[model samples]
Target: MTKSLIDILDLSTGEIDELIETANRIIENPQAYAHKCEGKKLATLFFEPSTRTRLSFEAAMYELGGHVLGFSEAASSSASKGESVSDTVRVVSGYADIIAMRHPKEGAPMVASMKSLVPVINAGDGGHNHPTQTLTDLLTIRRKMGRLDHLTVGLCGDLKFGRTVHSLIGALSRYEGIRFVLISPQELTIPDYIREEVLEDGHQDYVETTDLEAVMPELDILYMTRVQRERFFNEADYIRLKDSYILTREKLDSAKKDMCILHPLPRVNEISVDVDEDSRAGYFDQALYGKYIRMALILKLLGVE
Candidate 1:
């Protein structure tokens, strides 16, 4: 059976630490690992639209001396001709050394992985999981704070439908002394599986609040998420909740001196552009880390020495 990253839990805590260490080393000496994936090929089969994740995977492969091939949208692939994910991945897997797939439905990537001839990565599958993004978030947290544990992390905005938020919480729950301030409206609170199964089951400390400012002071890391319009079934409900949390320069006044603000990018109006000038803004840096961490992940998945 071929290995795949269908969920963040697929990797142990030690593996995450190893990936973070590899990413840091790559940051320090990128030239040395340039040829790690030479002669390898990566297939990016994005059935949904994406700018950052897709490009980062492509860029990671390129930087690792590997080639990238695949469609950026479903219509561009054989899926437009009514081909199943299993067939598409099985065929593509024969052509590429690894596969990264994103689909609108949950567990689609898992199905793809079972049929894939090589390693398969879930670029994203609905609002289910995006393990690589979780890996990126972990790397960003480790880089900025120098520690992943013993800190209060604030996760603000659409926790109910944000896959990145779900994945982040799952990954962070493994660490010691990690308190979560889940900031969202009552209507947009986190899923029961995460709250009951992951947090409550693990006996992790957490608090849910509708106010972002009230918890801003206590946070060492603030992970903000946009209220995604696509996830909503009703337009009226989305319009009402979309502006629930907006992080601005003034909001940072109450925050800790060294608090790091992170966002899984392509942010809508959730984060004001002016906050980009703030010293604590780590979202852009977070995106850059995504590429390096993905580079490390590609190396690991491909069994590259």
Candidate 2:
């Protein structure tokens, strides 16, 4: 059977843990895994612009002594010439041992996976899912906090359209004693389906609030997200809500000294630069972990792990 990671739920809990364990081992023993995927190739079919995820995938493959090939944007690929995702993946599958794709349309990678012969990992699909980012978040929390369970995770800013938050929430809901403090503008609160279906169905505990300061004191981990101007249909709404939850040094004074702060990057001021100097700031470290976890992912998908 072929395996693809289009959603966080595509991997079982055990599989996710195994990936994290492999990632950690790779981090600690880089020399042993240097040639893990030496002869393989990864195709990064990114239809949308990406900084962190795209570069991280390339870096991961390179670190594993593998090669990477593909276009950074749809305009640079045959997609711009009207090639369908299925056609593109069908063709690329023959060239690369594995594929990590990001597309502006929701479920575009899923569509590619159906036609692809090799494993397809979803880098991001519209604002629908980014399983690899979720993996990075989970690994960061596990490595920093020493446990994935028994933590109050506060998801701040743009929850409604934040794919990382949605995927993280879904992944964390499977763990015991995981509480969610969803902090966002009322209009940007988690979608009803996620709140009702994922959280409620699992009988997990959660709270929704517009106030970041109110929840700062109670969080074990704070996952911040940018108010994406691209996600907003109205320019006025984007302008009004972009600064709704900036994390400042003053705000961190109320948080636990051991609390970890994480963000899926290319951040635009949701987190104040002053907060970067804090020991609790784990976003930069989280970005590093993104590469290690991705290396593990590529190795796994290519049957190298």
Candidate 3:
């Protein structure tokens, strides 16, 4: 049977640690892993527009000595011609060794994985899940903090529809002493399913607040997220909450000097540019780590490790 990554929960904590270990190896020595995927092809079927995820997937394949071929947006694909996701993925499976897909609809990749003949990676499915991003987040956290357990993780911004936030919480909940500080406007608080199913049921320590500054001092990792305009049904509501938590240097004073500041990029004023120079800012390095972790994932899914 072929392996697919549609949700972060699909991967065990041990598997995550292995992937991080592999990623660190790739980081320390890139040439040794080059050509691991030689002659294999990765087809990226993105139904939505993206810069980081898509490019990183492509870069991952390329760095591993593989080829890439796919459309970047729906308009560029047969989806623009009324093609179903299952049909698109089924067809692409014949042409490529693997597929990494992103769609605007939640569970579309799950639908694709069912029909795909090859392994399927869900890049992002609406605001439901982004397993690879969650992987990247995990690797970033493990590298920066030197451990995944016994720390407070501050997730701020649009948590209600933030798939990265949802996936990260689910993954981290498996670790010991994982406390979550959820900061977002009341309208953009985390989904109840996450709060109930993941946090409450797992007995994870957490607190919900709209205030970012008040909880800064306690966080070991501050994962900032953008208030996605695309996830909002109402523009006015998006406009109101978009500026909810901008991390400035002054705010960093309250945070631990060793605290790691992470953000899933393409910022929309949720993070101040001045914070980029701070030693705590790991978001940029976080983006770079995405490539290496993705390289490990591609190798894993391909059975080429």
In order, what is each prediction's RMSD in angstroms?
1.9, 1.8, 2.0
lDDT of 3 by residue, 79-193 (tens): 9999999889889999999999999999999998899999999999987889999999999999999999999999999888787888899999999999999999887898898
The TM-scores, one per candidate, come to: 0.95, 0.95, 0.95
> Candidate 1 residues 74-170, lDDT tens each?
9899999999988998899889999999999899999998999999999988878899999999999999999999999999998998889988888
lDDT of each: 0.92, 0.92, 0.92
lDDT (Cα) of model 2: 0.92
In model 2, residue pairs whose N, Cα or C atoms come closer than 3 Å (at least 3 residues apart or on different chains), thus clashing, are none
Q: Output the lDDT of residue 249, model 3.
A: 90
Q: Which regions in candidate 2 have their CA more than 4 angstroms from the true location? A: 228-244
Better of 2 and 3 by TM-score: 2
**Decoy 2 TM-score against native:** 0.95
